[model samples]
Target: MTQAVAKEPAARPRRGPDRYVPFTEHMGVVRERAAAGEAVFSLELREELLNNHGRGHGGVVMTLLDCAMAHAALSRVNYEREVVTVDMHIAFMGPSTGKLVATGRVTGGGRSVCFCEASIVDASGDVAAQAMGTFRYRDAA
Candidate 1:
């Protein structure tokens, strides 16, 4: 009898406008341009993003915070360079419903690393989560 093996699926190449930020497309994140070293991202509440308790999932909120902080760090560098998360800390303040908005700003940094802070706000403008992150800048290619 011949042995059978399972294969993992291949990663797909990103295309179109979201190529620079592919996750934004997958997560349905929308961006609002901000000043240098700052970023703003938003998403609408959907059933798929909700947890069993009918609130936004913590993982999704964390992802939004991370992405916002990463974008803030990236804004400080050349477009050809990308920022990778080094360390992150987050705090959940409350449940999130309706439209969610995350805003991030670079607090401090050096040549290769940046420090950033972000907060996720619900439709009522209440902070649902806060996060701090350290990111390292590197060449895209």
Candidate 2:
């Protein structure tokens, strides 16, 4: 037997993912682009988002990565469903300065789960953080 696949959303003007996520909005995280099994998000380092050393706070980094990875998982299903991070492990490389970009890709998984990896690079193109995560799919409605 085979399972049915989800339908994709209607096409729209080229921009960020056509969705409004309150937390992402509150943190100023923008979904720059998304495709099947891939997604990229970005955020500007603000005073409140920075740690004492003038780098992005750990919470900020983690949230950005989680969002990006979970989106990647959702995209694999044509975004017909939502995904939640079941487990995630992140490594902070060094100070993240200027605008930061996080890119996520679906490594592997089955229908109900996805494995993803993401990395954050600063404006200077230095890697500031990397993460691996597991996400489980759920109904969008």
Candidate 3:
């Protein structure tokens, strides 16, 4: 299937010094409902986000996982600051199609590091991919 994330992409290069979610002219990949650290971001999937075989690209899946993981990690923090991804492991279970939603929750919290896990679901409500990640609270550093 062709899984595409069709939200207006940020003008910033994917790999750049300003990697901490650049503010975009458009709502871009990041939105309010998805920013509260509790809600999920739903992106419409299309062929552009597909792989060689036309399946959901691993990069897109990983990005979604990372975003969700950050949200989950942020839920444990009381203050606002950047949280760097320490580690992230994702397991692709099924092909992602249509609207892809990702939800994250904190598994554990600490003074220095936080552990979180998130799952990406397809339109059919099946988990297309799951992620477990650890993040270091920027302010805590």
Give lDDT per model, in order: 0.84, 0.88, 0.70
lDDT of 2 by residue, 1-141 (tens): 999999995664332357766677788999888889999999998998999998899999999999889888878888787777899999999889889999999999997899999999998999999999999987765
Taking every candidate in turn, the Cα RMSD to the unseen true structure, in Å, is: 5.1, 11.2, 9.0
Candidate 1 per-residue lDDT, tens place, 1-141, comes to: 999898875665432223445666677888776458898989887999999999999988999998788878877773446778989999999999999999999999998889999999998899999999999987766
User: TM-score of model 1 relative to the true fold?
Assistant: 0.83
Candidate 3 collision pairs: 4-45, 4-46
Candidate 3 lDDT trough over 10 residues, lowest sum? 23-32
Which stretches of candidate 3 lie above 4 Å from their native place?
Answer: 1-39
TM-score of each: 0.83, 0.85, 0.73
Off by over 4 Å in 1: 1-18
Across 24-82, the per-residue lDDT of candidate 3 in tens digits comes to 21223443343334536556667777788766788887887777677656655533555
| Deviating ranges (above 4 Å) for candidate 2 | 1-16
